[model samples]
Target chain A: MNFSSKILEDAVNEMSQLPGVGKRTALRFVLHLMRQPEQQTDQLSTALTRMRHDLKFCKKCHNVSDGDLCEICSSPKRDETIVCVVEDIRDVMAIENTSQYRGLYHVLGGKISPMDGIGPQDLKVRSLVERIKKDGVQEIIFALSPTIEGDTTNFYIFKQLEGIDIRTSTIARGIAVGDELEFADEVTLGRSIAQRVPYESSIKN
Target chain B: MNFSSKILEDAVNEMSQLPGVGKRTALRFVLHLMRQPEQQTDQLSTALTRMRHDLKFCKKCHNVSDGDLCEICSSPKRDETIVCVVEDIRDVMAIENTSQYRGLYHVLGGKISPMDGIGPQDLKVRSLVERIKKDGVQEIIFALSPTIEGDTTNFYIFKQLEGIDIRTSTIARGIAVGDELEFADEVTLGRSIAQRVPYESSIKN
Candidate 1:
């Protein structure tokens, strides 16, 4: 009874690794895939491989870019005097969709969590500091998540940039508590950016 | 080394056939599956083979059942005279989820289509007509989609039931014109069932 086609079992094995996927789900998902047009499956495989290969971190901002300098960092239309700091490239895309923030972005690549063994130096913090110093950026906004790790990273960043001639702020507290920036609906994320508050103001309180 | 995994590739090929998945997606899906705990994959494989093997169409209403009759069709609690005719078992599950419907169901297997060469006889229409006559049903509700094929099937069934004591009706008109019954939201589907108008009355208008 256990004898089944090996490829299906093998495909099912690989599918089970995705976030939220279990073995049963992997089988169903694989079966669902089996019913589609051949080209559709090919396209999905290409997209996944391309997502891994074609995309690279921009040298300037650490955001995903096809080139050395990310599009936003390299674009002349962007405001070099203001930099928005975020956890990942998705955050950069989230901010770009608002059409409200014309400033550039610096992706930290990840948050600082001592418990998980992640530290500030392990992130792109050095590059962000370098960008602020050389690009003549007057404002550096910490648009990182509001988690404990996020807060720790934000303050660590703030202390690093304290001597620099730039101001620092964060997106407002209006976002639902425990909300990650990624899942915030466009309207909520936009409103939060619009209502950004001074980083030191929160620190003093 | 073109030692590319053959079983993995064949599994991906099979998965790429699903409704929305492509080969690329199938590869990722298969890769995800490959990473699962071994027994989990084994159980999933068992379920896939079992779903096809253990499940059989009920002789009374054509819905997938383990034995001669499905749960709803066999249950003494259901309204036997009030039959809801649907495209397949998915529709049966959809109606069952609401817990509001008390009528037994007749799964037509599929709708009529000249292009596909599927006609009334190709479906379980003859079985449905036989059940209607044998059961002396008082009401027959057509719950097919709003497509031309579904309409054609409904009209064909309506004509077949002529001179019977049954009152023929189709699910109401407000549902989006071309949507299948499988995709409609529960509220819309339930409302359609509740507001069903008489077939003769709609045809007259």
Candidate 2:
């Protein structure tokens, strides 16, 4: 779309670069910003710039943090010996929201996808291995998604721990809680049946 | 949802302040930014800041611009005698995209909506009247929406143009091209029939 103003066009161009936002949505967002107080625009720009400039990555898990270690990695209450490996920080937040796991996390930053040119080396795989060996982690849980890339990443990490004494496992695949079985995909349903746990174990959660 | 990093939290809080963005979507956007190279974030932040800080409003039409006057208002190719008054810059763009109107535009910035506490005094209505008198505009077309608020704003402007020699008109309301007649609303269908023009006049377009 043609914009009358250069600055308005520039703002929309930048906004449309986001994942799901298109030109029209960007225009709407820019117009909304224009309607608000100039201070609101300043706040938004300051917050985004500050976040980008001042943000740090956790040395241990590669998650975003204010300092050397993220809250989950530094918390004494979290299980340091049992680490849950995830694709990114969003997975860390999702698992944290569940409040079911007490283990620390290893954020790979991305899955090992050959199509995207992201190999095991591109991720935080080396750091995770070094962490397990240095920290003497007892068990490593693969909490990655059920995609082929997730399986490949899990296998890659499993191979890396070949000589190590640490035990490795993946999260159980099953139908989501409160979901209808009839609507579940065949692969998931079959996997749920194959990995059926004891009634007491399932009910406990 | 809780954020592990303070910078992430601040960015998400500011992003979610946009019209349609929620906390979850804001978090998703923030995380997406975090995953990209630092330069991408810098570009986005820089563009937004520059747009907000350096943007100018057109002196005549109140539309966004880089200089004192907007592109349409400053262009000699545009018809200075006929002006289309719209509710906002988006409306001006939508009308311009049609390429049917050769006249300049006057952006009201907003419509008269009592429910939203917006009135005639809050818009650029005075400047529109001043332009018509000073520039000797022959015709004024209302390109606002067919909403009650749009009608209220139109009537308010019409009252201001009393005793003026300029001819006033509104955009026609009818079934959209390629739209099924059966799907058309009763009010729109009735208005279209009541304001029916000669077949020759309609076919000329």
Candidate 3:
């Protein structure tokens, strides 16, 4: 699209660089911003710039933070020894939102995807190992997705724990809580049956 | 969702204020920005802030511009006597993209929507009339949408141009070029039949 103003074109171009936003959507966003007060645009730009400039990564979990340690890691109430492993901070946030687990997190930054040229070394794998060896982490829970990359990363980490004295586990896989059994995929339904928990154990939760 | 950092939370809140973006989507955009180099974030913020700060509206046409007059208004090649009235700059861009209209534009800024408390006075309607009278315009085309508000705005402007010598017209309403007749809405289909042009003229176009 031909923009009449260089500034408008530049702003739309930058906005379109975001994931899921196309050129037309970017133009819409730019025009929306134009309709608002100048202060609103200033506030948005200031927040993003400051966040990018001063944002810090937690030294232990690699989650975004304002200082050396993240809020979860620094909180005394959270379980330090039971660390949940995940692909990124988004997973960390999702698991945290559940309030089901009280453990700390270990963010891998991204999964080990060979197709994307991302290997174990490209993530926080080394630091996780060092953390397991140095910290008295009793249990490491794999909370990654059920995708191939998630499985590969889980296996890679499992091998890394060969000599370590830590109990490792993965999140349960089954039909979702509210989903109909008839609609469940064949693999998931079969796995749910094969790995079925005892009635008493399942009811305990 | 709880964010680990104040900066991250603030940025997410600001980003989520945009239309159609929820908190989760905001976090995704924020994280995507976080993964990129700081320069990208700087560039985006700079472009937005600069555009908002230094942007100007064209004096003659009221379209977005960097100077007193917009590019379209200043271009001698465009027909100054034939002005196409539109709702906003986006409409202007859309018509320009067709590469068909060579007329100048008059952006109304918005349509007449009583439900939204927007009336004729809230728009650039007065200036449009002044331009038509002062520029010796021969014709004025209403390119507004077919929505109730769009029609109301067009009629209101048409009434304002009653005493003027210029002829007035609206963009044609018909089934879209590639649309199926069976799927067309009742109103559009009826309008297409009632406003049918001479077959020879339609074929020539």
Candidate 4:
């Protein structure tokens, strides 16, 4: 779109660089910023810049942190021996929100997607393996998404741990809670049936 | 959502202030920025801050401009006597893209919506009237949205120009060019039928 001011155009172009944001949406965002008080724009810019420059990744899990280690890694109560391997920090946050998992997380940064030119090396896989070895992690949970890339990354990491004496497992794949059985995808349904837990065990959980 | 880092949380919170962006989307944006090079974040922050701080509105038309007068108002090719009044700079850009209207534009910044606590006094109504009187503008075209607020704004401006000898008209309200007749709303269809043009004039245009 034709912008009347060069400054406005530059702002819109920069904003549109964001994932999923289009030029029109960026323009709307810029206009919204213009309508708001100057302090709002200043605050937004300062926060983003500060976050980018000052934020540190947890050395243990690769999750965003204020220091070398994330809150989960620094906490004494969390089960450090059982590390949940996931694609990114978002997944860590998602599991944390559930309040079901007390174990620590190892953010993979990304999965092995050959199509996107992202391999095991591009992710935090090496760091995770080193962490497992150094920390004497007993159980490694493959909590990545049930996609081809997710499976590839999980298998790659699992292969790397061939000689390590650790219990390896994947998160359960089944019909989501409150979802109808018929709505579950075929692969998930089939897997759920194949890995059916005993009635007593299910009830106990 | 539970954020591990305070800097990340602040960035997400500030980004979420943009229209239609929620906490989840904000987190995505923040994460995407984090993945990019530091230069990308710096450019985005700088562009937005500079735009908000340095952008200027045209003295003549109120459209965003680098100088005192907008390009449209300053152009010698544009007809100074006929002005198309619009809600904002976006409307100005939309009309300019059409390339059919050679007249100048007068931006009202917003419509008269009592529900939103916006009135004629809150808009550039007075400045528009003063402009028409001072510039000897012979015609005023209302190119606002076909909404109650738009119509009220138009009527308010019309009342302000009571004694002025200026011709007034509104942009046509009809079925969109590529829209099916069956899908056209009743109000637009009725107005199109009531304000039917001569067959010769319609075909000529």
DockQ of 2: 0.74
The C-alpha TM-scores of every prediction are 0.48, 0.95, 0.97, 0.96
Off by over 4 Å in 3: none
Give per-residue CA lDDT, model 4, range A1-82, as digits (tens): 8787899999999999999999989999999999999999999999999999999999889899999999999999998889
Q: Rate the local accuracy (lDDT) of all candidates.
A: 0.72, 0.91, 0.93, 0.93
Query: All models, DockQ values?
Result: 0.05, 0.74, 0.85, 0.89
Off by over 4 Å in 2: none
**Residues A99-118, candidate 1, lDDT per residue (tens digit)?**
77988888897899999899
Top TM-score prediction, candidate number = 3
- Per-prediction RMSD in angstroms? 13.2, 1.7, 1.2, 1.5
Decoy 4 TM-score against native: 0.96
Which TM-score does chain B of candidate 3 obtain? Answer: 0.97
Share of reference contacts kept by candidate 4: 0.87
- Model 4 stretches with alpha carbons more than 4 Å out: A200-205, B203-205
Chain B vs. true chain B: TM-score per candidate: 0.81, 0.96, 0.97, 0.95
Clashing pairs in 4: none
Candidate 2: clashing pairs of residues: none
